[model samples]
Target: MDPADVLNVRFHYGGEFIRIGPSLDYVGGDTAMSVLERDKLSLPELKGFLADHLTVKDSMKIYFLMPGRQLVNGLLFLHTDEGCMQMSEHITDAGVADIYVEYNGEQDEPEEDASGSDFEDELDDLMDNDDEPDAVITAEEEDIVQGNVQAVNAVPEQDILEHILVPNEGGVVTEIISSPVKHNIRVDALSQGSLPRLSRF
Candidate 1:
């Protein structure tokens, strides 16, 4: 892909977390920490930075060097008050423990009204129960009705892709790997930044 063609990309971000994906130029043997080291970041300081300042809310986009078949070494760019900084490596690690916070963007169509009118009446009964003065609730019942109200309680998806690794201390990334995606490989936690909101495109 032409470097210019990659422009206009959208990043997903929330309060702190940002949305990211594997770049188009992932090398076969790269990790978060390794990239950080390559960039001359100090590992110890990087750890302190993450501990001191990092928050991963749901829907935060994080770019990573995808292992295996899909890998690339595309420029991972971030917009900041100073301007844009395009890193040659992918964002390997984040402070938040959750690696990926995917929401139901395109849900599977509800099992085509399998219960028909009976389903409708059951749903109505459940709705009426919500108004009951003191209705006994069970875990099973809650699960059954999750579809009806989960969206209201669902966390809003992160809407920006730009992030900043504000180095409270400053350090480097050594390794980073997703277990399900890459088994037994301990991916390093790279430096964390204070990602500001901006146009990822």
Candidate 2:
């Protein structure tokens, strides 16, 4: 395993978030980045940097560490400026996140259609309710939601700290939910971001 072999690279076994990509002027070419470098860049930039260095950007995927030291699929970075989330904000200075480089080619076979199309269509119809008027919401609804969110959305400082602590891995745990369930369990609300809508009302 020569260090120059970019197709099959793995970073050091540290950090809560194990970054799977190639080295970008960090570490001794074994890991993707150093602790200081990981802290300097925001999470989005770190992802972008990885994509920029890859020959197979399309196959690249990102993962973030969650509560209880679990790795889960992260937001896909379509563009460099998708969001302004800082790595330091979530990861601590002493935290050690590693990056692994590997081959990520597209699937050879095309995706097959699911067998539950009819059932899915029926569910969609029930949920969409197209017959309902599009302009159902009034200014009053927006005002109430905005007021409620602003007043009650502040996450407790300690609770926030709790979310960032991964069990065995290193790096800072800046933000996350209390749950350890994988991406399969996330709904639109929890998946959206921190401070998910507490209520639909």
Candidate 3:
């Protein structure tokens, strides 16, 4: 298949990941889809590769890697009697180029000096050490700051979805699957108050 016709989807698992370039030639098929990588493998073959290499279990974290390497979090795979698997419809609908999976035993440790308490202390110290001691906070300045904060806090849930759904300049949004399973994935992500910012993606 032509490289232009393939959609590159990356699978990140436990510090190791594989990029599978599935052909956009067909929509839904029980048969395997073509892939482009170092060792070319089909969609089903790639799934089998993940099953064998990554530890599949319940409670695993899944994320869609957006453009510019931004990770939109809170996507989780369904764990059935067979194994953990993301709905095939969801995959095709998102038209995602990358998928990050945090399986059991593949959790990343926090970076050194990156704990929440340490961050808070650092911020507090910075605020306390004002470069200009004579600087006074005018009423207008206070109002502006408060207004900005309120605007951020008052952002509607649909706004977040719009931010993700709307295509950027010269970019096209792939058709998304409107199944309940896929809808729930997005809803859950929104509920967490951690939607990806427009500027970031």
> What does candidate 1's lDDT look like per residue over 1-201, in tens digits?
433222121222222222356433222211121112323233232332333333333333344222222323422222231112132232223311111112223322346555578878798879778565678779999887896578534633332212333323446433332222112121232223222233221
Question: Best to worst by TM-score, what's the order?
Answer: 2, 3, 1
Per-residue lDDT value at 131 in model 1: 63
Higher-scoring candidate on lDDT, 1 or 3: 3
- Per-residue lDDT for 102 in model 3? 54
Off by over 4 Å in 2: 1-31, 35-44, 51-56, 72-86, 98-104, 107-201
User: 60, model 2: CA deviation in Å?
Assistant: 1.5
**TM-score per candidate, chains pooled:** 0.16, 0.25, 0.24
- TM-score comparison, 1 vs 2, better candidate: 2
Best TM-score among the predictions, by candidate number: 2
State model 2's lDDT.
0.40
Off by over 4 Å in 1: 1-57, 64-84, 88-119, 122-201
Model 3 residue 104 distance off true place after TM-score fit, in angstroms:
4.8
Error of 2 at 10 (Å): 8.8
* lDDT tens digits by residue: candidate 3, 1-201: 555443445565554233336321112212122233423434444455445545454455544443443232334332341222232323443354454555445454556754469778888888989686687889999999999989866866455443335454778654332333333447666687644443423
lDDT of each: 0.32, 0.40, 0.47
Q: Candidate 3 regions off by >4 Å?
A: 15-46, 72-96, 104-201
All candidates: CA RMSD in angstroms? Answer: 44.1, 38.9, 38.9
